[model samples]
Target: MSQSPEKKPRLDDPCINLNLEMNRKAHYTDSFENPSLIVRRGFPINITTTAPIDGVKLVYIAGTKHPQRDSQRLFGWKLETKSSETNNYQLTPPSNCAVGRWTIKFTIDAKEVEMQATILFNPFCKDDQVYMECPEEQEEYILSDTGLVFIANSWRIKPQGCGWVFGQFESRVLECCLALLERSPLTPTSKSSATLVSRSMTALVNAQDDNGVIEGDWSGDYSGGTDPSEWTGSVDILLQYLETEKPVKYGQCWVFSGVLVTVLRALGIPCRSVTNIRSAHDTENNLVIDIFHDRHGNRLESDDSVWNFHLWNEMWTKRPDLPDGCDGWQALDATPQEMSDGCFQAGPASLNAIKSGAVYLPYDARFIFAEVNADRVYWREDSDGNYRIKKIDKKHVGRMVVTKAIGCNDVDDITDQYKHKEGSEEERYQTRLAVTFGTEPDIYENVEDEDEVKMKFHCEEDYIIIGQPIEYTVKLILKDMERATALFNATASVYGYNGKFICNVQSHKCELLLPEQKVFKGRIESSEYESVVRSGSIIKISVMYDLKEATDMGFLEEEIPLRAPPPKVEILSQEPYIVGVPIQLKFSFKNRFSSALTGGYFRLDAPGFSSRDRLEIDQKLLEPGIECSYRVEYKPRKKGKINLVVSFNSDQHKGLHTYKHINVQNSKSDDF
Candidate 1:
């Protein structure tokens, strides 16, 4: 028998390979090494085959149910040969194409080849609905993964930055993100629209109505799950959810916002976390937060609440589903605060609509409008079992709106972007317009203030740090100098970050004769709130004044947030770090409190430099005024700019997180 020669591969062979490496770079997704080609729409993608073909067509199919040809979720495009190359061709997805993972099929010479790729909303393309003209904004909102979340009480303190690692490009994150879309209640056709997908995600991020990612728990009980404050990033939470196929145990507003940002950025949607200080939760949707108080000036339970600070996500997208000029940043909240359209989701509400008081627009615009512009009405119960409005604060809700600045770690005040200047004529006009569209259009129709006494609560210091006495002043201005006698009462209570009352710290009652202008100074000893401050609670002081001569009452309250001194972080290793080399870091903090500190621990997390599991160091007790130091060693795995985040938690304090940027160089050197 003679040995037969092996047949060479032919141009029309069944085995065909498509080259997408060049397309990845052009699409600006070369940084991510995904199994499928990740691309943004409206950009040309060059495809080269192993052999020349007679004919070619690309088919894209999204979702598994009721797929129709040329539909929004299912479409195909024919490619033209590029220049004179036989095996090279070019294809461009329309700017309005569906955004998600798509199954692509190439039919060449009557042979079908199957592959997968993910298409994202393109902000760089001028014709894309989600187009953002500013290049700086596109880089910050769409590409930046790590960011700062502002957490503070705007009433008495300035906003502070908390480092968050989104880790959108981490291994398996894109797969997990696509899985979330599959688990949503959206129909296959609805999933094709970016606005609908964002709306569905608000419900999918929390485990309230659906078995989604994070379960919200604000009861201060972490017996079975991790605490929300201890979470360093979204990578662990997402991976845990994918692995167990169950909702993670506990999370808060910031956690929900953080995870949603990761999912959106991974899917190529531009998103950022926003913090609204003194955010209102309007249950009745009348744009009024009604707080009830007893005759003794003690706060009673109510359906409405004003959180110390609330965090939500803002996604940049076009709003063809809405009116014109509503195509900028859209607010989307996933904290599961309230239900919308029979589910626990909120927004895709246009920020422009919110600012312009177009609360009648689609997709829960009124609810979001109230969140940033509601009026706080205090109702006091009288002897006849009737409630009377004691005071109304117009500037209480939405005191400050902020987010992370572009290309920096600074806080960007976006208050004007959401609403006009407070107390301005334009602001009042917009408020009136929004109120007219509310469910209770006549809420402020007959309400009037007839009382003559006015009360104002002021904090003596710019900010109150933990382990220090809190000092404040209450000034009462009596118009007409009527020489009135009044009963003054001050009560301080510890309130959680979720605006839930924990326990009363102290109370003081006094009888005073009001002068033309009277000022009362008060102090809350550090010992009174030391035990409760460890739970990350703020001190809410309620001041009540009853005027005997005028038979009227006045109430004033202020929330004081105690700032924690951050621990100093130092990189002991020299600069010019190379890949695969170990680096040393040192963290030190002093116990400034009068009492000893116990149950102290430090958590270190670096997305690319460290493992999926965070590094934790536990410590023993440290006496007062004692300085504690810790040293950690981390080795770089890749070369780039990496962020090293360190957080300290103890029985005396919690959530003291900070980050440092480390630039790692490549180990290999090339000669010029």
Candidate 2:
């Protein structure tokens, strides 16, 4: 028993003892939640603790989804007092600290206390009262990847899939951007960041021509017959612009806004897209969007139009050259709708100043202001040929302006951030004050008798499945006791999520006599639209009725839902694939259709796979009664259950998918 020397303990043994010290647990005398405010750079941030704790070190970490590389030491400091606990610590972040959501951690004794906060690039050090009045997510939303967005001219805000915003930056995109930089007159020699922004905007839209980069084509028919969804990512669009200096065919306001967001983000500027519902375009600089109607009360299109939804961008920056109140969150519109300073670009207009009715600020502030705060006037000529207002809608111009929430996929109601609540005393006051401050006196003086045309409008269905007819009924319930004539115009228009119109599937126009209640019915047959339209199309229904004494108008819009495309092939694979071993796949398909399909291809995508592009078929055409099979192999790079997706598409058939889950086990053998 006294015996042999005890075997030396293994280094990996859990019971092996060594020099170590136990850390103390963090215990606070008082508890409090983190503040919901932005931490300005180059400013001292003060944090207070319940107990007086000394020997404490504070570390600030940047927020990132990746846990491994998440902790970035922005600022570090130690307590200076001799007491066991230091009640307060003031930490100052460097001037170049990143502007984003950040976490602050305190190593008290050996334990840790953590809190979350936001960092902003406000150089002027605006007071908390001002920043708080703006909006919480204004800075965060613009800086983060996720954006709360509005689409299809709808007021409801929802999360939109913007994966393209974060797509891998291609070399060609960078090259094109760099080429623009070379051609730009802006350099370090320029003092204002606005100059760099202006130059970048000029290069992005090629500011010389209104249709330089993306042709503002509402008629659609884009380049390569590509739809807005097919445009893929910003890199693809930018490269297309560089390779061929022609305007990409289809770009609406949202497309222009999206592209501008991508370019601004790429250029290291914090930007976000904001949608103004019932946005007005006052072409006359009259501070109002004019609506003209014929003597019969039929609505007529005018130079000044109101887009159901208009999108523009807001960039975070300090404007040193502008007036006192004009700084932070400058608006920029690259849609090329109007000219600014002899160019088609608009804004870098200050949102702060925009709020206070500083329409006198430079860079088309008057036009931008009119978008959200313009008057909507319906005018008609009397028998005497003098134009008079049929009705006036002040609250309809800007409603429910929204943005994306920070760190979440939800809508951020920034309507208050843009303007006051509709019809509120403050709203009326701001409107009147703004007009008095800058707008002409005659714009608001022409208020006339309200046209008492009361109508209730709705759609039977909100969405439509692709390759199907769109059936909807517009019911008009006239509350006024008057005989009226209703003019109905309904069109099934295919558009991108960015509001780029692809084509008009079908258009219908009819005249109806309005009684107490009348149902205006319409249908878009599948056969009529199957070839011309795809998913993401909208049925825009407009009804204009003129009463003998007065006239009014009504409108309704419906979104079409697209069903998943039919499967083109069947995939055969075995379960439990061996890691480091090849898994063979067989895709069997038959083409029995009358037409031949050229550009027939199959694509396989999965995690840890090295496939770059879709595999091309040896023979392009698949004639009628042709049976074809494709064989491919993939070796699992990791061991686990992997979702492998196989897709097949042709010039005729698009977006066919087949997916399977395959269990992969690690292998001991190097070669198999």
TM-scores of the candidates are: 0.91, 0.60
Q: After superposition, how far is residue 622 of candidate 1 from its true place, in Å?
A: 2.8
TM-score attained by model 2? 0.60
Clashing pairs in 2: 52-85, 52-86, 53-85, 53-86, 54-84, 54-85, 148-404, 464-560, 464-561
Stretches of model 2 off by over 4 angstroms after superposition? 1-150, 156-162, 166-175, 191-203, 206-216, 223-227, 239-252, 433-440, 465-537, 546-672
The residue-by-residue lDDT of candidate 1 on 1-672, one tens digit each, is 834323332433344444567777787676564655788888876766655544333434444543535322324444567854557777677777767766555554445454556787787889877788898887787776667777766544558888787878777877788888877767755765778888888898999988999999998776698778777688888888999989998999998999999998887778999999888888887788989988766679888888888999999888888888998889999999888888899988999999999988878888888888888877778888887776677899999899988888888889898899999998988888998886667666445465566778888676677779998888887876568887888888888877788889888888778784377788888878876763346888888888887667777788888776677789999978777888999987777776788877777767664324434344478787888878888887656666677787776566677788777787546211
Q: Supply the TM-score for candidate 1.
A: 0.91
Q: Please write out the lDDT profile of model 2 over residues 1-672, one tens digit for every residue.
A: 533223222322222111111100011100111213334444555555555433323333321322223243334322343333645555554444443445554443433455444443332334321132234443343233223334434554342322223221234443444344334444322312533454356435533463356766545344454444333235455667789866665666666776676555544456677777667787877777777776654556678766666778877665666877666677778877777666677887877777767777766777888888887877776778777776667866776676655554446677776677778787776677666644454556666654344444555544544445667666665566556666666666655433344567666677667674477666777656555443233444445554444445544445543332333433355555677778777765555444566787766655444223567677678885576667887776655444455555666654344455456677644232
Q: lDDT of model 2 at residue 31?
A: 11
Predicted model with the maximum lDDT? 1
